[model samples]
Target chain A: MVSYVETTALRSPAMWFTANRLTTGLLLVILLILPFVAPRYWIYFAGLLGINIIATHGLNIMMGYTGLLSLGHAAFIGVGAYTAALAQIHLGLPFWIAIPLAGVMAAVIGVGFGLPSLRIRGLYLVIATLAAQFILNFVFVHWQSVTNGDVGLTVQPATIFGVSLNNETRIYYLILFAVVFMTWFVVNVIRSRVGRALIAVRERDLTAQVLGVEIVKYKLIAFALGSFYAGVAGGLLAYFNRFVNPEQFGLLLSVFFLSAVIVGGMGSTLGAILGAVFMTLLPELLREGALQVGDTFGFDIALILVPLRETVFGLLMVSFLILEPRGLAQLWKRAKQKFERR
Target chain B: MNFFIEYSIVGIASGGIYALIALGIIVIFKSSKTFNFAMGEMMMLSAYFFYAATVTYSLGLVAGFCVALAGSIAIALLIERVAIRPMLGRPFIAVVMVTFGIGSIIRGVVGMVWGPNDLQIPAILSRSPVMLGDIFIPGKTARAFAIAVVIVVGLIAYLRYSRAGVALRAAAADAITAYSMGIDVRRIIAFTWIIAAITGCISGVLMANVNTLTPHLGMVALNVLAVVILGGMNSIGGVLIAGFIIGWLEAVTGLMLGTEYREITPYILALMVLLVRPTGLFGTKEIERI
Candidate 1:
């Protein structure tokens, strides 16, 4: 058999940046100008989308790259939210410090729950995370003195320099910065030695161990890293919503993130962004559609709108799993390949 | 002391129902290595079907039970054929998420059809309180316990002695060997789902009778996950004992600590057990190799 191998090495940082630099520059410019041009609701929605993209990135790392499925992701996010809230209220910390601190706290708790991953995987690990979800939520609701007992905590506006980010447009910039930084961080991490180790552990831990991947260390690292992203997102959420409540971080939200990760394309950063955008926009699209139908038919959509959204959400997950397991990322790749060929 | 005895009685009775639900989960897990995350939703859907048959359509109790059982079995079979059969060699997480997706669909459908408000299912069991010497047990609880125990005992006996049951056990033990031995592993898998749906329907109705009929009735399965874990996922009989233990723990904690504690105690115990002994009390130890 005869074969040929093609290899292209980057000559310089400028050359590396120049390849696809137009698209990257365009995306950054659009994102920068979005808040100013778009309606208030859209800016608010974009902020939420950015937060979701960050959290979904965390999940993609653990589930997509590391092959550890966590059902308690929202709980870790809750941990970060609460930690950020408490730090701001009690310690008088700024948003930057509070957000990082939230990440650290959630990472610690995530490792605690992730301890079981050493002994179990797949279904058992999922149940363990489910337990973490309920247990943490229980703590949030019952720890009256700390979490305010379901009434939740009111978060103060995050101040940067002398300006308080009290509005969506202001907070959107903060979230936008975090999203870019986190996305860069995640992409770099996935290309590094640690990322390869995590992926190896995910593929088959026994093999990874034999290959000297240090399965235990990487597994915990995956959890810590994933939870840290969740925590950071949660902190942003607290500042964005100007409130932190138990109900906001529930099993449903965790499932939502999981579905996002799946629908986006596992193990791909672009997929995470796409999935987050799809999921966030889906409900809005449904509501708008429902209103159009209602307006035309003269029937109340209030009754069916929630159920319809859930049904579609579920149907999307099922169809994606069945038809395109690689998710939207694979679709995009195929499209690009076809276009380039043309 | 009196309160303790009373709580124990009620707790154990409720535990019997939990065992019934856990049996459904165990049966499915034993045959196919897939954990049915939608088991709770299956139960809740059947309960809703029963409510629709009995209350909305006025079919009465016996006919309603029959309709619910058939509906649940059909749904279970449909799930196996459509969702599960295609996922034969897929990753475990994908299958698990598919089940979650199915569960969400069922919940949403139930909410749409029945509305989210709590609806009363016509009482199948007597509601009056029963006195056992000085300790008092609620009538519905006592009767539901009796029904659940009877069903569980019958199932245990069937699995132990019957020919079909033996085939199921054989398949569960080793699929290839069982296939070579002239057993239809696929049929057995479907059979186990039928058994699960039947058990889920019975327990779902019992739970709805003891509590209230709502879309969230499936949440009881969260507690049952604790039982399944503590008892071991594949252990048929261990769930019975673990169910009672968790039930009693919930009752006692609810009495002492508060109602909020009742929800979390099982999860804490399950987590502790996972950390300490992941195989659980009666579960078969999984041996992994390259």
Candidate 2:
């Protein structure tokens, strides 16, 4: 009897590039033309989306890839924000230098918080991160001399050869480049030896340790790298918003980023991007719909709008967890497979 | 010296409320092995129900309390059936996120029903000062503290001796064994949620009396997180002691450094406890084979 075995192209680089490059090139072209084609409001929205994509990528590295859940992620972003603000205001450093400095500062703080992870895992680690969130937020509010005591600090725009990248359009381009770089960097990292080790630690730390993976080292690296991304995102946020306040980095925002990571797809880079876009756009769409409904029904939109948005946001998160735990990425893969089969 | 004594009494009284809130969290954890992050929201929602009953419907204090208790129980059961039951065997983070999502929904609904402003619920306790020997305690605080103590002690006794309570404990300890012994584990879980809602309702009313009712009332649950951690997740009696310690510490810190510092003391203490003893003061140490 003769048996036939189907040959898999999983190990072929040609197949991978041919499949990915077209979509990648198309996305890049769209992002590049978004400023001109999209309205001013959307350009501003795109900038904010870019910033969130960066922060979500950082969180995805920690929670999605490395299996370390951090509820204090916003605190790390805040750290980067304040660091960049201080660096620019006090040190008079340019945006180029200050942003990287912001990331480094956040990475250091991330390592400090990550130390507790060595001693604890799961729920305890989450609590430890929560402590970091509250404590750092406390510092932001009370440290009047540095943080301006809840009034927050105003940030200057990025400049190249003394031309201010101040407006939404210009900042959109800056954010666009940063997002592309960070996304590429994250994709490469996920394919590297360090990324594999991090994934190994995530799958089963004990087994990974038994197999000679330095669980401690990989865990800390994940925290540092994740926070570094958050910090850079924060720095960009400061310049983009032209302001940084304690409220912007609150616990709710941390939860927002976590939800984005979960909704995107935990371990995939494409998932991070999709999740950020969906979460950011969901609220705006809800608000617009609420306003239209209120106008038509002759009821007050002001009171119900915020609460309605929150309700929908939460409902989506719950339904996503229940109905699609693998998130949009899984759905995307399924669709792709169907198309390919056809 | 007089001020110190007064603050201590106030702090301990507030701690009683914290202990009550922590008790709800511990009960849910014990029965289902799922930490209900929405406990604070549950407490806040119950308080809002009381506000709606007494203020909106003019039901008076006694009727309002009953309405609030029933409302919280219904909400808790609804959440258990809709959100939690579907997520029974999911990962720890997923369950936690689901609860967080449920919390967000509750917060939004409360805000929509009752605007964002703080509304005063009809005061259940008196306002006159109580002379406790040399130091005078606020009447409302003293009365609320007494009520909290009675409830805590009563719950302790109920759990210690009651047959249903024993069955609940058995289910918590070993669900498979409890199931084989003819105990309905699912019913016990539902019962635990009811107990949690009851505790949350009482404490929510007490808390609203102490502080005004607002959507942000749920933020107090963050403080309870510290108490839950310090006492240990699985330890019932330990939470009481931990609650008192946290309350006292918050009062002292607030006195010394101001209100800003008071907000963070529990988290700092929780972090310290996590660093020193991750299992908490009374948590059972699990020996994992894998």
Candidate 3:
């Protein structure tokens, strides 16, 4: 199969790009150019996309590659965002320092949540994760001194050395850099023995156990690693927005993040990137339709559009599930295959 | 004693609403083994239909409410046909997300049609507060609660002894075996959804009395989750018990800790319950592996 794989994909540069590192490298290069060519609003949006990409990738580690359905994974992002925001404000840590601290804090918190997976499995574990979303969001909202209730804590610009990341363009680079490193690191992890064991467990934990995989260690590791990535994404989001609010992280967004993975194609890192890009950008594109419809009706329609947007978004999600359940990444693969056939 | 009676009464009233929602949720979950995460939205949408029936069509409130039931039942079957049917035998995530998607669409359609403002429902109960001694009960909230309790009890009785109800229970217990036993399992599942819709419709009307209706009514999502988790996801009886517990707790928390804390309480409890018992108080424990 490996020899056949080389013969099929190696002959064309386009095929090589689609099937290998070149496409990934090109995508990174394009992401770098995004800030310069796009409007400031879009730059901020793209930075948000990167942050979501990070979270989706983290979720993929558990849901896709490792075969765990963590419905409450956004809570880890909450842990990272709120904790990093707190550390920056109270402990007076630098943004860079606080960001890493967020990841570590999230990983530690995730372990507390992940311990249940050692005994429970499947949808029950998903429900258990749902508890994390509610609890974490509650802490962020009720812990008044730190989170300031729903008002959220105001954040200062991220500083590295003496330079401030004062603009969306600058923050975009920081998010971009973080996403690249994490994606590369995670992809490498999936190629390693740990990755194989995680996949083995996802396939069948009992079978993996018989094959000498430490199910407890691997499950915890998946949770910890996934949560760490979510934390980093949250920290970046907090810093980029220059504010951290409880409302931004909720079960709705958690569902949104999970949907991104599902619609992008589960079990693939590239799929996470495609899903993040599409889901993040989808609202903006959808808003355009609302605007056009409003123009027809002769009044500003943004408020009315809010509800319609959810429906449209939902319709697209259902359509994807019904028509192309494999998501955009799978669609991309199919398109590439067709091109090569010609 | 007055305080206990007041808080307890308020709790049961609200719990009655949640218990109905939970019952709707449980009936569907028992059959399909999936949480109807869309329950809040389903109720919210039906409430809009009820509004359309009562006000737009000039169907008097009783006739309108009955019409709303028919509309909701129709919507449920439509949803099953359009959104859910294609995903049959797909992974659990697809089904869950589709419901979430359906929820989003419902909110949008309702908002688009109804506008963003909360609809001021005409008073079904008399404007006066009814007094028993020193305790004053608002007529609307109390009546809604009573109606909800009566409906829930009646439904439970019907399900326990009725042939159709028995078929639903049998199908829920084991789909394949029931199918071989000559039960039309798909039809039973569809029927459960219709029943779910009817319950959700009643919940919406009750909720409308408590708070005005908006597309954002879907935000009542946490309450349903709390009931299911607390009651045990698959148990109707458990749901009834948990519903009042949560409702009373929320009211007491609002009275004692203030509304913000009250808002946070149910979510915190859900988290605690998940940590302590994921199957809920009555849910069946699942087993896969480490």
Candidate 4:
């Protein structure tokens, strides 16, 4: 059984620090060393992993904490990227200002889409959320004047506090810090009053509603906060890549994000991080291995299997679902738990 | 007059195909409370099956139809056993997500087999547009419309009157009670998927002829989700009507506002429908007891 903390607030700081120390240490080491030790290609790949984490964790808030399935996470990210790109290009706003603003804009629109959750539940709610993705994607692709009419908008590299950071290393640190901060924010929220209410609503909305939870407000709040995370992620992605295209933020990306959450554990924040990393890099690593093997044997196997990316990815998801539904987060948790028990 | 009549005729013709796709979704939703997220992918797969049977091996229409239909039935049953049946007693979300996973898997399979290229479907009907007054509708689209109408009306009638169809209705309404009443709910579930596959195959072939057959064109069938929402999940007639409404709306809107607006219109309409008729046009209100 899942053992949530019994007390709403932890009384012992000692236990808290002791319990989380290993996790913190591991995260710190990964954060410090991976950027340096990883190859340039991997560094770029890892940065993309961070973006996936942002979106996956945001989806975790919606689908996990609030129990609202959103098929439109990528669409919201599209909103974020489009808004940030437009502001950066047309308004000449600094990257620092535009990204957060884009996040805010996406959050507002996320609430607009989230309004349906008040009446619809389960499968109906899912379709309703899907409508948001379709509507937004169409608007993004079609609204030519605002969205550059399918030829995507370009933005300049980011500068923080008058220090222009152009290289991937600096961008890596920026992305790393953003993800860290976002992770910290989500963890803090989980330990907060609002997060508890959100969790309660997800567990059973009627009970929560009967207990004076205000279902509509919470549903909308869940959507806005979740979207805020996605927008921030999307904004970061746009600035990092220096361009935004509609194709990059389509329904498939939405599916990939969901795959991450599912392959991670749904409700856990660490699950989001682990899922994003695995989902993003697994294919690249597989392809790399295939190419290396093909090169050694002097065959054309890699190109033949190159298009099987989604098939392999999908098969992995099914295997995970059938064999280990709890995903990578559970494995990490179990190992840590066993170590602590010893 | 020319533009108006032309758009309407073309509109209805395309809308007819959409209606068939919607019917496929409706049949599946009738049995499983869960939406088959892979329905469009199933359509694409069936289209490929038919194409391979006909064009790849150069088999004529009759042999291709029989083989494709049988293949689709097997595939649907296989999916039921592997992807769906195992998750029978699990949470609803688990089932929905699994269907999506299965969909991705199917898409990948189709991509691998079909080589990610557009397959040219042999013209089943005439290429020239049929002229009526100032309205000139494409010959194939009109033929597709005629075929779709026959299938819809025929199936709807069969479902309404047949004994087996009554059993399906009974099982769908209340599975446990139907089981106690000696109804084979599981068998009905299997039948639902088979019927859904047939619907998919026919629609797929029609759509391939309507537009070019591409693996990615299945994305359009994702719009069936909107139709299901508007019509209500369990309502077959509602889906057919909603499909026409959506089809005509898209055609008229495409005429008035442009093509891009046409795609977005369904979602916008879906949002409004969710706000107003949350249970949808025919869906009974779902009661949640905490």
lDDT of 1 at A243: 90
What is the C-alpha lDDT profile of model 1 across B104-151, one tens digit per residue?
889889888888899999998997888888888999999999999999
Ranking by TM-score: 1, 2, 4, 3
Put down candidate 3 lDDT per residue, A52-113, tens digits, no spaces. Answer: 99999999888777767776777889888888888988899998789889999999988787
Query: In candidate 2, residue A327 scores what lDDT?
Result: 80
lDDT by residue for model 2 (B61-126), tens: 899899999999999999999998888766677788888888888988888888899899998999
> TM-scores of all models?
0.96, 0.95, 0.91, 0.92
Model 4 stretches with alpha carbons more than 4 Å out: A1-18, A33-38, A292-307, A335-342, B287-290
Window of ten residues with lowest summed lDDT in model 4 chain A: A3-12
Ranking by DockQ: 3, 2, 1, 4
Candidate 4 residue pairs that clash:
none
Which of 1 and 2 is the better model by lDDT? 1
When just chain B is superposed on the true chain B, each candidate scores a TM-score of 0.97, 0.97, 0.94, 0.95
Score candidate 2 by lDDT: 0.86
Instruction: Give the alpha carbon lDDT tens digit for every residue of A164-227 in model 1.
Output: 9999999999999999899889877877789878777766678888988887788889989999
Q: What would the TM-score be for candidate 2 when compared with the true structure?
A: 0.95
Q: Isolated chain A: TM-score per model?
A: 0.93, 0.93, 0.90, 0.88
* Reference contact recovery of candidate 4: 0.41
Q: Is the docking of candidate 4 incorrect, acceptable, medium or high quality?
A: acceptable
Tens digits of per-residue lDDT for model 4 on A46-87?
A: 778878888888998887677777889999998999888888
Q: Give the TM-score of candidate 4.
A: 0.92
DockQ, cand. 1: 0.44
Provide the TM-score, chain A, model 3.
0.90
Minimum summed lDDT over a 10-residue window in model 1 chain A is located at: A1-10
